[model samples]
Target: MRTSRFAVTVTAVLALSALLSPFGTGSAQAAASTVSPTGTNNWSCKANAAHPNPVVMVHGTYGDMTVWNTMGPALVNAGYCVYALNYGSQATASMVTSAGELKTFVDKVLASTGATKVSIVGHSQGGTMPRYYLKNLGGAAKVNDMISISAANHGTTNTGVTAKMVGYPTCVACSQLMSGSSFLASLNATDETPGTVSYTNIVTSYDKVVTPYTSGYLSGPSTTNIKLQDDCPADTASHTQMPSDPAVIRLVGNALATNGPAQATYKAKCTW
Candidate 1:
C-alpha cells in the first residue's frame, strides 16, 4: 500500500510539473523580457490612495515568483503596486523558515512602498504558509487582506503518500502539508484567522492535489470560503491552474477591494 501510494504521488507530482512547465517556465521567461505581461519585483512602485496597500504575491510548491505572471499583471493594471518573491527554495523548505522569509520580504515591501499594511495574494502552499507569518511572526499587524487560491488551509488527505515520503531529507515541507501533520495542528490550534486580517479562500472543485477541496476553507471570524462552482458552475480549473484562472483572479480582486472578505453575493463569471 505504501509503495502504491508513493507511485501515485510521484506520478501526480510529475504530471503537475509537466502541466505547469510551459506556463511556469516558458511564459515566465518570455514575460521576463516584457513589461505588460509580468510586473513583479518592481521595487520602485509606491502605494496610492485608491489602492493604499501594496499587493504581495506568493507561489506554491515547486513554484517560483514567475507563477504570478498572469495575476501580477492583472493587479498592476488594476492600479495596485504588486510584488512577488521566491521563498523556501521553491516552497520546499520548512514552513516555519518560509514564514520567517515571508516576514522579511513583507517588511521590505512595506518599507519600500511606505505603506503601513499590505494585502496578500497566494496560491496553494503559498496561501497556507503565510498564516504562520501572521500568527507567529507579527505579520498580522502588517497585513490587511489575505486572498488564497486553492490552499490547503486545513491540510490534504494525501497524507498516506507524503507521510512516507517525508522520511527523506529533501521534502520536509511535503509532510507538513499532509492532513493532521504537527505543523497544521499547531497552525489551526488556537485561531484559524488571527489578527484583524480578512481571509478569503477561493477554491475549485476539481483540485486533485488538495483533495476534498473544502479543506481550503478556514473556520474563523472575517473568513469567507468560496467554491468556484458555487459562482461559476462551468469552471473546471485544476489545483495548479487556479492561479491563472480568470474567474479566480476576479474573485481575488473583489476580495482585495472590499473591507472584509469577499462579498457572499458576488457571482463569478464562467471564463476559462
Candidate 2:
C-alpha cells in the first residue's frame, strides 16, 4: 500500500511537470533587485497601519536573502513591510536543518518590525520549516499567515540517490528528517493551522526537486493548498520558477487580498 501510494504521488508530480514545461523558465536577472536594510542588519519597512503585520521571506537550502529581492520590492510597493533572512547554515552539508533555526529568526523579525506577528512566505524547505517554529517554538501565536511555495512538507524519495552515493545512512537520515517522522507528527498534532494564523500552500506540478509534490499539502480547515495551473489556465511554471512565476505571484496577491475567498480553484492537466 505504501509503495503504491508513493508511486501514484510520483506520477502525479511528473504529470504536473509536463503540464508546466511550456511556461518558460525564470532568470536571475529578471528576479534580481537591490536590497536595503531598514535598520541595523535587519531588512524592514514601516507596516501599512491598515495591514499591521510585516511579511518575512525565507529562502530554501543553498539560498540567501537575495532569492526574494524582486518579490520583496513588489510586496513593498503593494504596501507591505517585507523582510528576508538566511538560516540553517551547516559547515559540512549544504542546506539542511532550517526548520530548527526558524525560532531564532522569528524572534529577530519581531524585534525589528515591532509587530506582534508577521506573515511568512517561504520556498521549498523554507515553506514547511516554519511549521516547526509555529508548533514547537511558540510561532503559532506570533504568525498571522504562512505562504509556502513548493515546500517539501512530506519529504522526497530522490534523496535515495544521494544516500547511495554518500552512504546509505546519510541519505536515509536526510529523507527521514524532511518527511513527517515522529517529530513532525508530534508537531502536526498541535493543530494543522493553529491560532488565528492562516496557512496557504502554493505548489507547482513541475517541481523536480520536491518529488511527489503532494507532500507539499497541508490538511486543515484553515489551510489552503493550491496547485498553480489551476488559477491560471496557461501557467506551466516549473518548481524553481513557481516562486517567480507571474501567475503564481498573481495568485499569491489574490490570496493576500482581504476580500478573497478562503478557498480558490487551481486547474491543471493530470495523469497517473
Candidate 3:
C-alpha cells in the first residue's frame, strides 16, 4: 500500500511539473522586465506607512520570480513594494542552500527599501522553504508575515516515489520534501511556526502534488490554515495554478492587509 501510494504521488508531481512554467524553469536568468510581471524586483520601491513592510515573493521548484506576475501587480497596486528572487537554480537545489540564498536576497531587499521587516508570499516549495530561514537562519526577526499558497510545509509525499520524471534527478530539494525526511523532521521539530512572524497556509482541496494538501498547514500561535473551498466552494484551483488563482490572491491580499495572519473568518470575493 505504501509503495503504491508513493507511485501515485510521483505520478502526480510529474504531471503537474509541466504546468508550472512562467512560474519558472531550470535556468536562473533574470527575467526581462518588459515581459516580466508587474510589481516585482523594483529596487527603487520603498515601503510606505500604509504598507509598512515590503513583500518578498519566493517561487517553488522549477519556478522563478515570474510566478508572481498576477499576485505581484495586485499587491503593488494595493500600495506595496514587492520583490522576488531566482534561487536554488529555480528552486531545485538543496533547500538548506536555498534558505541561505533567501537570507542573502532578503538582506538586500531590506537595505534597499529601508524596511525593518518584510512580509513573505510563496507558492509550493517557495512556501515551505522560508520556514527554514525563519527557524534556522534567524529570519524570524526580519519577517512579519508568511503567506504560503499550496506550500509543502511538512514535505510532500509525491516526489519521493522515484526519479524517473524528466527533471526529478536534479531536484535535490525533492528528496528533502518527502514525508518523514530528516529535513522536515528537524524543520518541524519543536515549532512549525516560530517567532513573531504570522503564518497563513492556503491550501487547495484539489492539489495533487502535495498529496493530501493538509501537509501544507502549520500549527502554532498566530498561524492560520485555509482551504480554498471553505471560502469559495466553486473554486477549483490546482496546486500549480494557486499563484495565479483569483480567490487565492484575495486571501493573500487579506492576509497582508492586516498586521498578522489572514483572519480565519474572512470571506474571499470569489471569481471565475
Candidate 4:
C-alpha cells in the first residue's frame, strides 16, 4: 500500500511539472519597480525585537523575485524588513550561478539590512539551493532559519525518464543542478541538518512537483517538516498555489512572529 501511494504521488508530481512548464521559464527579475503595500498591516509596521533577522526570499526554477509579489509586502507590512533576489540563472553572463551564487546575495542582504544574519524563505529550487551556501560558502553562521516551500531537497526521479529520453548525462546534469551534487553530499556527510540554523520544510501532500514530497524533509535536530494538509486538513494546495496560498501566508506569519514551530490553525475551504 505504501508503495502504491508513493507511485501515485510521483505520477502526480510529474504531471504538475509538465503543466507548469510553460509559465516556469525565466530568471528572477524584479517583478515591479514600485513596492505596493498589502493591507494586512500585520508584519510590515515594526520589526519584532525577538526575531531581529530580516527575511530574504528566494524563487525556484523559472521563477524570479516576483514569485513573492503578494507575500513580500505582507511580511513588510507585518513589521519585518523584507528583501528578494534572483539567483541561479542559466546564462554565463547572468551575474549569478545556481547554488553557487547564493553567498554573494546573502552578503548583499546582510550588508543592506545591517543585520548580521537573516532568515531565508525559498520556493522549489530556491529552497534547495541554500545548502550550498550554508555548507560551502560559510552561510550556516549567517542564516538563522530556513523555510522551504515545495522545495526539492533530494533529487527528483522524474528526471530519470527525461534522462533516458534526452541522453542520460543531460538529465543527470539537470537533477544535480536542481538539487545538488558532490558538494551537497559532502555537506550532508558532516551534518544533515547543521545545528547552526533552524530548518523548516513546509510542504503540501498535493504538491505536483518535487517528486516524493518526502524529499522536502531535512534530517536534523532543529529541522521540522510540516505537511500543509496536516495543518489545514482541508487545504489541498498544489505546488503552484503554495507561494500565494492564504493559509501558507498565515502560517508564515505565525512562524515568523513566534520564531518557532507553531501549529497551523487556518483551514482551507476547498476553494482551490
The per-prediction CA RMSD against the true structure, in angstroms, equals 9.9, 10.7, 9.3, 9.4
Report the number of the highest-TM-score candidate: 3
Would you list the rank order by lDDT, best first? 3, 1, 4, 2
Candidate 3, residue 121: CA error in Å?
0.4
Models 1 onward score TM values of 0.84, 0.71, 0.86, 0.72
The whole-model lDDT of each prediction reads 0.77, 0.58, 0.79, 0.59
Can you tell me which runs of candidate 2 are displaced by over 4 Å? 1-44, 90-97, 160-173, 176-180, 259-272
Pairs in clash, predicted candidate 2: 17-206, 20-236, 230-266, 230-267
Candidate 2 residue 27 Cα shift, in angstroms, is 18
lDDT of 1: 0.77
| lDDT at 66, model 2 | 57
- Ranking of all predicted structures according to TM-score, beginning with the best and ending with the worst: 3, 1, 4, 2
Candidate 3 per-residue C-alpha lDDT over 1-272 given as tens digits, one digit per residue, 9 for 90 to 100:
32233233233333222223432222333432333456467889887888889999988876777667667766676668888787887677899999999999999999999999999999988898999999999999999999999888887777542243454456678788888899999999988898999999999999888877999899999988999999989888888788877678778888888768999988776662
Q: Put down candidate 2 lDDT per residue, 1-272, tens digits, no spaces.
A: 32233234334333222111111122111221234322213444554576677777776644455555445555554556777766653101223255556667767777876888888888776776687778767788888888888877776545532333311123222443356566456656746666667888888777776778777888776778888766655666676667656555554555555432234653322322
The clash tally of candidate 4 reads 12
Cα displacement (Å) at residue 81, model 4: 0.6
On TM-score, the stronger of 1 and 4 is 1
lDDT preference between candidates 1 and 3, better one:
3
Error of 4 at 199 (Å): 0.7
Model 3 alpha-carbon drift over 4 Å, by segment: 1-35, 160-168
lDDT by residue (1-272, candidate 1, tens digit) is: 32232233233333222223121121222222122225566889998888999999888876667667667766776678988887786676899999999999999999999999999998988899999999999999999998899888888886432432221336567778878899999999979999999999999999887877998999888999999989878888888778767678778878888889998887755552
